[model samples]
Target: MGTTAYERVLSVAVAALHERDPEQLWPLLAADLPALCGGDALIYKLDNWNESEGTLGLSPGVTAEFTALGDEDMGLLRAGYPLAAHYASGPDRAPVTARRVAGRSWSQSRTAQLLDDLLDVDHVLGIPLPRSTTPVTGCMVYRSGRDFTDDELRLAEQLQPLLTAVEQQRQLLRRLDTPSQEAADVALTPRETTVLLLLGDALTALSIGRRLGISERTVHKHIANIYRKLGTHDRVSTVLHAQRLGLVPTASAARP
Candidate 1:
């Protein structure tokens, strides 16, 4: 793509971030991919960790069929695959991309096989989607019949930061819309709410107990009650939910 095209992509990405909506980001990403590398593109986001679920597409028609491809097609982007794996393992890390694959095996996956039969694509370039301190939340794939040029690779690299910014903005929007457990007006003792707020601030149980002049076991009991009340299974979800309810400040917003 030309410098003008790259500049347009960056402009679109920034605008999408400001909108804080996934739907707005899709067309910009879709348009930029074909310009950067003459190929159809798909964006996928890691959604379910245990099931290894990732969402594909940009908007309503988007699906996770690409990552669900049979093992063969996955090997072409080994670096991308592992990078996603690592991201799923920890959602607080930045995304990584597999710019190039070792061989033509990328053409062998179910998606590739279908594309080959229908459209004749043979090469793949995978770029990870941007994320905050979480595992790779998503990726963008570029598929074409011919090898990518050096210029195309350079352009993709330049676009990485833009993609990351888009991802971070999406995540922030999600957090903002996420409802807090405390917001349900679920009745809790004053001490329980205090404990929940402290947890949201990332205080350890021990530290919470010390601060509240309670025993650690007592703090743990309060946490257990908080989890049950919030229908949360872990600390992270509880804290995120708490923040959504305006019961706590996000880490970035909290007093130092």
Candidate 2:
């Protein structure tokens, strides 16, 4: 990608990282990704195999095409064409194109024809996010005339890590949103709970303030509220108390 395009994608990635709502992540990515990657449209998939189970987010441009599909067509799309089948049984999680996966048989394959007939796209590039093997999580880009280029594939690989970080942030936000016994007992506001989670990471007040885009004084105020709610004096004790309450994941329980 050129410098300008790289900047645009970077800007989107940064905005995604700072988004506090997990549900917004998919829409945000879906909107910008097609243009950035030189594709006509895109979809972000949470799980693709089960008709009733998975979530799908389409780019604004492709929403109508997706909505036009019948129940049976939707079911077939959820089968994830060829890429999901390949990724599920193997460890190669790199981004791949459907044409590349199916090679000379691409035009004759039912999956390819289905996508072409339903979504009006002749090719697809699957960019698998860093997630579980089953259910097939990630974005799929579509363009009509040709497959994605080597440079586009390289760009997808470059983007994998940033996408992973954003997803991780989304998961953390999700946990904070979930109603739990510990959360009910302490009654920490969502923002304060986020601050407390940062405290558990040993971030200074200034660092927490920077992380949340607030002033150090505001961070200190949140810290004070957390201490009072958790009935603790210092950061360590506050974190320890929160951990014991199951408000935050314990050190050992934290994901790598």
Candidate 3:
């Protein structure tokens, strides 16, 4: 892809962050991804984690093109693909290429074998989403005949972080649109929200303390409250869950 294609794709991806309707997010992805990545197909999956129960949620109501293979494909995908194991393991947001994973006995996986027969898929590249945070979302590119060039792979890598941000904001917008009692009960305070905003910016507790005119210990205290309210164990999940609850400020909203 040329600089123009790269720029356009980036613009669309950034726009996806402000998309008013969460449901439109995937259709937008299906329509835009092929042109962006030079791929034959795309798939997106979202995983949600609860303190009580672990969850792997495939975002429903996606357009058929993204899910043309049908719902049963999940079994094949889980059995053959590395998503579950990847989610289970830590350091949550690294991208995994099919080439890197090709050593995983694909021939032995019944689902992978079925997919190969059905799609004639020769190559794939994937990035798990909501970058740098949990609930284990994944986005994958499929090519039927050729391996991804380093350039195309680079493009996927570049877009992964942007789309991860988009997913966070999309979920936030969805929650804001449909007011829920549960979300309401768990909403962060004005102070906690301020701290989370800085956290999303990757600020340290000292920085947040200076910004908020609080001590580092106080910053940590608020963060602990934020985590407990959000049911998140660490900083990244707290930041992401804050984003989902519309507690973190959006990039556009932060600008002058």
Per-residue lDDT tens digits for candidate 2, residues 114-189, read 8788778898888887555776688888888878899988888777766665565566666543547766777786
Better of 2 and 3 by TM-score: 2
What RMSD does model 3 have? 11.1
Better of 1 and 3 by lDDT: 3
At residue 110, give the lDDT of candidate 3: 58
**Which runs in model 1 stand beyond 4 Å of their true positions?**
26-28, 47-52, 58-100, 108-111, 118-120, 129-137, 177-256
Per-residue lDDT tens digits of candidate 1, residues 24-88? 56555665555554546554444432233344454222334444656444433332443445555
Candidate lDDT (C-alpha), each: 0.56, 0.77, 0.61
- Number of clashes in every candidate structure? 12, 0, 0
The regions of model 3 sitting more than 4 angstroms off are 48-73, 78-80, 130-135, 178-256
What's the CA error at residue 107 for candidate 1, in Å?
Answer: 3.4
Give the lDDT of residue 245 in candidate 3: 68
TM-score of each: 0.49, 0.72, 0.56
